[model samples]
Structures are given as C-alpha cells and as structure tokens.
Target chain A: MKTLIIIRERDYVWLRTVFPDIHPLLFPICNKPFIEFLIDFSILSGSEAVRIVSDGSLIDVEEYCDNGSLWGTAISYSSIMSMDDQRAVIEKNRRFCSEEKILIISGLVFIQYDKLHDYKSLFASQPNGDLLVCNGGSLSLTGNPPKLQKNSAPLSLSLIALDSLDGYYRLCMEILGFASSPYVLPGYNNEAYCHIGRNVVISKSAEIRKPVMIGNNVQILEDSIIGPGSVIGSNVIIDRKSTVTESIVLANTYIGEQLEVQNKIAAGNMLIEPEGGICITMDDPHLLTGIKKSGSVRSLLRFLVHSFAALLLITLQLIPFLILSPILTIQGKWKKSKNIYYTGTAGETLTLTTTTIERRGFISSLAAALSLDRFTLLFSVLRGRLAVIGSSLELASDSNTTLHEVESWYHAGVFSYAEAEEWPVSGGDKAIVERYFSVHGNPFLDITMTIKAFFNRIHETNTP
Target chain B: MIFHVDGSTGKKLGIAALNGRLDAKNSSELLTSFERWQQQTNLIILDCSKLDLIDSSGLGAVVSCLRKAIEKNGDLKLANLSPKVAMVFELTKAKKLFSIFTDTGSALQSF
Candidate 1:
C-alpha cells in the first residue's frame, strides 16, 4: 500500500511566523517530530510506501527520515502547490499509486490511534471511501477494498489545530498529562511517561519529576528541576539553578544559568508563547542562545599556521620525504588516494591527494612513527583546504555521518583537537572537551594544541 | 526604586516599589541593601506592581532575599506583580517560592 501525506504551506505558515526556522514537520510534540506520528500511523495502516507532499522545502525532514529504511518502509518526497486539492494531489501521485491501494493522509493533523488494534486489517477491509475524517486532515481510501465487511465501529479521531504558540503549549501539556499514549511512542516501555534519548548528563543535584521527554546530548545542570511536564530536544543545555516545567525546548538551545522556563516553546534564542504568537528573540546570552559547531575561521587560521610549519618541516625533511617515497613504493608499502572533505563552515568542499606508507617494516614504522602519512595532508593546509589542529578530517563516508552526530565537534581538520589534549578521540567525554575548546579557544591556543598533538602522535607511535 | 516600611501589621514590613528596569547594574545594590533592610525587620513586600522590566540578575537578587528571609524564619512576600514582572517570576519558577498577594496592604495585614 502507498500513503500520500499532504501538508500545505498555509497549514504551517502560522508556526513559521511564531517560531522562525522551525520546520513544521520537525516540530516536537514530545521530543518527537510531529511528522513521526503521521509516519507511525501510515506504517500501522499497512503502508508499503510513504510519500510526503509539501509546498515547503522538505530538506530537513528528508535529512531526518532518509528513505525510512529504519522503519523497514520506503519513504519518498515530492513538492506540490499549496492550492492543490485532493484530486490534484492524487492525479500528481497516480504514478506512485499505480494499482496498489493508496491511503491519502491529508493536512497537518494529529491522529489519535490505538497501537494494539489491527489498523492494517481494518483499513484494508474498509469500503472504498473516506475511512476517517477530522478538521486538521482526513484518512481516505483511494483503491479497491477487500470483499469482507469488517465489523468495526468508526474510530474517534479529532484534529487539534496546532496553529498558535499557546495551542502548541497546551497540546504538549495535554499529551504529557495523559496516562497512556493515545499514539504509539518510541524508546523504552517500562520507563513511564518519558522517552529520554542518548548521552544526556543530568547532574545529581538536578531533579527530574517525570512525564518528560529529553533528547540526546542534553545537560541538566545542578540545582535545576525538569518536568512535571517538559519536552527537551537534542543538543540542549539547561544551565545551573534553573527550573523548566510545562514547556518544549527545541534542539541547539542554550538555557542560561538560573533562569525559569515555564509554559512556552524555546527554540534556539527565541522564546515563543504559541497561543498569542508572542515571540521574543532573547538578546541576553545568559538567558537563552543558540549552540552551533565552531566555524572555519579557526580552522583556516590553524591551516595557515600548520602550512607554514609543514613547509618548515618539508624543507628540513626534504631529503627524507624524497628518499623514503621511492623505497616504500618499490616495496609496495606506499598507497595513495584522493577524496573530497568538508573544509569548514564556508561549506567549501576540497579534494585532497594523500599517501599512506604501510606500517610494517622498520623504515615504514619510522615513517609512521614520525607521522609521514600526514605529509601530503599538511600541504592541504598550505592550500587552505584543511585545518592543522581542530577536528579530525572527515572522509565522505559512513564515518562522516557518525562525526556529524557528535553535534559539538564535527568540524573536519588534519590534526584532531582530541589528539592535542592527549584524550582518547573516540569517547563522548573527550569529544565534549575537544568541542568546547574548538569553539572557545584562541589562535595562540591553537598553536599550543598543534604542538601538543604533534608530540602526542610521537608518543602514541613510540608505545606501539 | 523607592522603599518604605509599613509598621501597622505588628512587624516592620518593607515595601520596595520597583519601577522601570531592575537589571544587573542595580540588582547588586538591591541585594546589598537587603542586609540593612533585614536589620530593620524580616517581613518584606516587593511591590512589583510598578516594575516594568527585570533581567536574570534582578530575579536572582529577589530570590536571594527570599532565601535570607526564610532562613531567619521570617518571610518575604510579593504584592501586585505586573504582567511583565509576573512573567519573569513565572519563567524562573520564583513564583512558587513566595506568597504572592494582590496588594501591599493585604500582604502586611496577612503577616
């Protein structure tokens, strides 16, 4: 079965006005994107394929769901005019619908469904018409129905128009206050009324009163209180001596020290009172601000310094780099490749040609020990395409995805900040420290970091 | 900000009528003077009815005064919190820590 999810731009216009940069699909009802609920409903209703049709850009949503393979379903996206009616939508997606049963889920609506019930069979057996309808959207059948008539009563589904900031706040409170989820929710089952994601640091003095959903990389500081009802998104920090009750704080937000957050939606620096649509972009960083990875200026500076240092090294080791290259190549121990890597926040992609001498024989071991494989990448610093000391340079592969997840320390560089700190680069704690310094550290600090990293690499190779 | 003590409620009660901005610059002064005010009496009423704006520092100082009064087993109550000041208190959850009244007279009378 195919599912057509239609959400017009007008449906989310009010939300955009209230909270700029918040994609309606990414709006959190309980630390879960509002669209996830719709997706869950489509999957439950036996959708083999789901296509999201929106007039607005679906890049953020697409980036998030990414073909829906995680849920074992095929997800595709399309764009349509905001004025496109039901028939026009069907006509446009008729190619996808083909001969299969198509379920058209329309509007930016919240559907209240029971997880235990067999909605798949119920939907399949229903007549060839609209199965359920509500104010926000409707669930309708677009193909032939099964032969048998299912003896099921019409389910009760209501559309709560999530148009205002107050309405959004009220919706969150209402959902949290409810005993059982009216819809299927993800995460652990035994933990009641909360779905906290990975890598959350809650200080011992911090108090959690339950019925809260906290996302990944969140820091609930000392003497702070969370919940009774709260939904905190990823990469958020609730600083010390503060309290948050009955509110939804979105991703990449920094809640400043000792401030109170009650009954509102805080996305980045903007505090939104959803009902009246009263939004204030806080000028005070101590109250609230946005959290982002460090920019390329630091990386570029490091690159320049490293390049000059690399030039000095090349001039000094010119005979060695030259003499070693032929011997290692002839012995089949030297390998070379070129790949594209993100240089910095400028979003410039650069192709770097690099050579790695295999770490086997005595000469190769000496080269590796002396960090000779990094020889060519150091020249990339001269080209202003790589950083000397910052984040580890990311290869455009699966590793890059993992690096992006770190939130704080994803800037790619030749020499990692973790290496400079002599901290194990793989762990979360080290990543936190490295990321903190990357954004906050100075150029003089970078020089020290690079020197430390160079010596640390020497130490690492000496040990093995 | 102007502050005067009402003595009719069997105890000296300081009514600090805050006006305009009470931010970082003035917050420390408010906190420092709170010590002298405590010497006069423990019962206090911050009449925020005239307060127009408050930042984190101002909120912190008010919370600190409440803590000091509570430690002495006396009390600090708020009266006639304007919509904006009430918002600051509500956001910080400071409203939960104090007894709020509609007017200074009622706060003093209750004490």
Candidate 2:
C-alpha cells in the first residue's frame, strides 16, 4: 500500500518559536526526528512508496530522508497550499494514490505502535475510513481497502496530538521513560534504558544513572551527573559538576560548570522550562552557551610561531630570492600579478603580489623548488597577517569560492596543511584536511607541517 | 531605576523598581544609586517586573548591592523577577542567595 503523510504549517508553527533553526518535521523526539517515526510506521504497515506532503519548506526533510532508500522504501515530496484540506491533498496526489489502497496520515501527531506486532496484515484488513485520530491529526485510509480473512484481530492503534510544548515534552518523557523498543531511537542501547551514541567521552568522575539517551560526539565532563531521565542530543557537552536530570539537552549545547539543569530543555544557549514553556536565551557564554571551537589563544600562539618561522625562512632564502627572482623575471619564467584575496575574516580582503613560476628551465625549476614563488608572502606571516600553514589561498573575486564546514576554522596561509599531507591542494576535501590540522595541530606541529609543506612543494610539477 | 522608601508594613523598606535592561552599560549606575538608597534603609526590595534583560555585570551589581546590605546587617530581596531574569539568576545560582518574591508587597511584608 502507498502512504501520503500530510503535515500542515499551522500544526507545527509552535516548533519554530522553540527551535528556530530546526524544521518542525525534523524536530527530534527521543533523539529521533518526528518524521522518521511516521516513516517507520508507514514502512511497517507495508508501504511500498511514501510521499510527504507539506505546506511548509521540506528542504531539510528531503535532504534527510532523501528517496527513502535508507528505509528500503521509495519516498517522494510534494508541496501543498496552506489551505489545502485532506480531500484537496488526495486529489492533488491522484496519480500517486491511483490503483492502490492509500494510507493517509495527516498533521503533527504521534503514532504509538510496536514493531513486534504485524501491523501490515492488520492495516491491510481494516476498512477504509478514519481508523485512529487525535485532536491534532488523524490516520485514515483513502482509495481502495484490500479484502482480508475474517479472523484478523483488531490492531492496537492510538494517536497523541503534539500541539503544545507541554504535550511534546510529556510525549518525549513518556517515550523515554518506557523502554525505547516501541520506536526506533537513535544511539546504541547496550543496556535497557541507557542508549549511547558514537564518540561519547564520559569522564571517570562523572555519574551516569540509567534511563538516559546520549547522542554522538557528547562529552560528559568530570563530576557531571547525567540521567535518571535525560536525553542528550549530538555534540553536547555537560561541563564539570553540572547535573542533568529529567532534561532534554539538544545538540550543540554547552551546560556550564556547576549548574543544575532539572526538568528543562536546553537547545544551544536557550533553556526552556518545558512544562511552563518558559524559554530564555542566555547572554553569558560561561553559563549555558553553544559548543563552538574558538581558539583565540591557539591562534595567537600560531601567529608568534609562524612569525618566528617566517623571519628564519626569510633570512635563509633572502639571497636566493634576490638573485633568482630577478633572473626568473628577466628570463620571463616568473609571472607576477597584484590581486585581492579573501582573508580569514568575513568581508575582509588582502592585497598581495602573487607570482607564478614556469618551471621550464633549470633556474626557474630551482626557484620553484626553493619556494621563492611564495617568498614575498613570508612577510605576511611576520606581519601577523597569515599563518605559515593553513587553508588554500581563496581569491576574493572568485564567486565560486564558498567555505566548507571545516573551512570556518580556516586561516589562509602561504602554505597549507593539505600541501603538507600531500592531499589535493584545492577542492572540498582539502579544506577538511586543512581544518583538521588547524584544530589539532599546535604551534610546534604547525612548524613541522610548514617544514613538510616546504619539502612537499619541491616535488610540485603543476602550475599554480 | 526608581527608588522610594516604603513603610506600609510598619517597617522602613527601600523599593527599587528596575525598568528596561540592566546590563554592563547601566549596572554601575545601579550600584552607585544602590549605595545612596541603602543609606535611607537597609531592607531593600528590588522590583524586577519591568526588567527585560540582565547580563553577568548586572547580576554582579545586584549581588554587590546585596553584599553591602548584608554588611550593614540588613537583607536585600528580589521581587517579581521576570522569567528571563529569573533564568539568569538560576543559571548563575544567584537565586539561592536572595529571597525572591512574586510581588513587592510580599517582599516588604517579609521584612
């Protein structure tokens, strides 16, 4: 049977106020996006194809679910008018709903179903009409109903309207309190009620009381207490001495040291008292802030180390640069151009004279191998303007130049870590390699990377 | 910040109504005015019903006012803390230090 899941904008408008960044359908319930539960139910009920119809933007959901190949089902997306009713949606998707029993699940509602039960046969046997519904939404059958044997027992089905924060919180708590066997919850559940995800670093001094679900890349710091009833999302850090009980700490949130978070929903810097729906965006970074990599001290140290390295390199390469640069220029092997390039800071540009060396003859190849082409840019390091080894030089006028996720930590340099690692010096993955070293590489490591990059540049046969 | 002496409960109480934001920009002003208000009466109630926002500096200034009041053997209480301001107090664990009330009348009567 085919399924059409219609989610109206008004049904999930409240979620926008709480989670501004997340789409309503992508809102996590028990560390799982709400739409995934619906998809799971459709798959269990023997849906060969599923189409998610929404009046709201389905970009995130589409990106996440894709063609539903992950779930072993064909999934499609369609747009609908805000005023579109059930019949209107069915009529719009007439081609998809043709020649089959279509299961219509509408609105922002939770379906309570167990995977152990054979819902496929039960749903196929049930008569077409409204099967189960709640205040917020309904589960109905449209098109044709399949004929079945008379011995089929009534399928246990129920719906809960997730229209308010209180209801949403209560539903999550209920699902969490119960063993997560009913729904497919993300994370590894080695023990009952304790589900953990990848790269979870729980400190030796920290306490983990059961009935908790933690997501990927979570750090429960020293003396931190997690659980009794807690759902921590991905990339969350519970700082030292912080106690999280009966709380849902969303992804990318940093719980401050010594803070007691009880019966709250923390999403980044905003903390919400779910029962009262009271929310407060914290202004202080120390208390309940977003977990972001801000390496000011490391950046300063890198600047000092790079400057010292640049000063040393300049001294050693001075005579070779002075002799080879003029000779290369006179030989028409060195091509120079003054252009603007993008700096680390947004909207900031740097004017630098870039030289391209044509490695045609012995003198030019010697100059290229000696890295005299990047000789003048060494001053930028001494001036504290660039790193010795960082991201690839991005041109300011290049409209196609977009920053990758890792490139946000990018510090443009004369030499890149990608060049040091012998990875592709330009492209998407190059930014990732550079960013990895930028975050992990210290001043000493940077010096080593710079040396490696310098030697690696000796073997370069391609034009810059 | 508007300060007035209230003796409705037959005891001298300084009621300071804080309006708008109490951040780094005007936190020192509150601290300076708090010293002058403390001279009139030590038992003070900070009415924060109109307080929309408060940063760390503002919280520090309020704590300092409480410290000065305690040095004079008096108490500084908070009243009608908005949810936003209360969240700051809770996050910083400053709520434990002050006796918070829902209204100014109750804060005054408690003294």
Q: What ranges in model 2 sit over 4 Å off?
A: A149-152, A292-464
What's the TM-score of chain A alone for every prediction? 0.64, 0.65
Model 1: per-residue Cα lDDT over B26-81, one tens digit each: 89888888888888778889888877778778888888989999999878899998
* Candidate achieving the largest lDDT: 2
Per-model clash counts, in order, read 7, 0
* lDDT for predicted candidate 2 compared with the true structure: 0.87
Which residue pairs clash in candidate 2? none
- In model 1 chain A, where is the ten-residue run with the lowest total lDDT? A401-410
TM-score for chain B considered on its own, for each of the candidates: 0.91, 0.98
Q: What's the DockQ for every one of the candidates?
A: 0.30, 0.53
lDDT of 2 by residue, A120-177 (tens): 8887778888888888999998777567643456767789998988888788888888
